[model samples]
Target: MRSSLRPLLVSIVILAAASVGASSARAAASGRPLGNATRATYPSVVSIELLGRSMLYSVNFDQALNENMSAGFGLGSSSMNIHNTDLDANKSATFLPAYFDYYFLNAAGSPYVTAGVTLILNHSSVKGTDTSTGNLEIPSSPVMPTVGGGYEYRSDTGFLFRVAGYLVAGRSLTPWLGFSFGYAF
Candidate 1:
């Protein structure tokens, strides 16, 4: 992590945490996306994805602000350590993905487009030995911006699934695919 980006990252994390915490503390809080009073009765969703914007996997949540709009967020993290006769190193990363979607139809199944920013929180350091020491970082920026569209099937019975393709500005501008499964209520 770069020193200059720390404060910005911390501020964002703190503000988001506070906002989410406060919303969830409300009398009727039920994982719904905080929005105007009119949207309070809409259902919210919780899901887990494989190979999505989080890079590997993420636990995701979505709050339906209305029939055609949704607000979403996700959290993902990973750590790796390697040690051998000559090299030892460790790396860790955490990701927070915030996004929004617009469903084309107000039905049980719909096609949607999404746009969001993913905060990449990471650190990698190698223990220095008499022989060598090293430090590494990828996708140098502290954030990744993404846009994509896909089909989502959300049933009245609380079942939800989505298969999405995304263009993510990470490491380089690349295309990524994600599949998700969860429940809405």
Candidate 2:
């Protein structure tokens, strides 16, 4: 089982790296579109959000596929071990999202909508003495669909801010809110 899992994990890492490299290469090979760049400086951003009781951090890298269309990769974890919980279990999960975004209202500083799939890895540990479940750790993978919309604000100092909200549909359907601030190249 260990040998089989090793290959699967390696493949997943390689595939993710390849996808990012491909997108970057495409973006670089193509020349900037006419007046399409706008004030949006960075194609990628990292956002940290507090989902009510849970905490999440994500890094989103985006590439403009065309004038009105863009795609991005969101990678992050929702559950982090900050302390020991006597009553509750310690849980953690990471999400990889491949999303398509549309800049429908392309005004000076307009809003947009994004929809895509989130491939998630969930892990949990009930290592406390609260329940019969002993030092426990489990991992699983699942894919979910999400949709979100937000406004983009461009700053004079070559920085951009994007705020968005997305929902994942599944057994533990989670809702996440994100705000990313970054500079363009």
Candidate models: Cα lDDT each = 0.64, 0.51
lDDT of 2: 0.51
Model 1, residue 59: distance off in Å is 0.5
| Candidate 2 C-alpha lDDT tens digits along 22-101 | 54564566565533545344344333222211124466667766556678776765543333343333455566767887
lDDT of the structure predicted as candidate 1: 0.64
Kindly report the root-mean-square deviation of model 1 from the true structure over all alpha carbons.
11.8
**Tens digit of per-residue lDDT, candidate 1, span 56-142:** 568998898877899999997533335323332345457789999998976667789999998875522322111111111235567
lDDT of 2 at 145: 71
Which regions of candidate 1 fall more than 4 Å away from where they truly are? 1-42, 78-89, 123-137
**Candidate 1 versus the native: TM-score?**
0.64
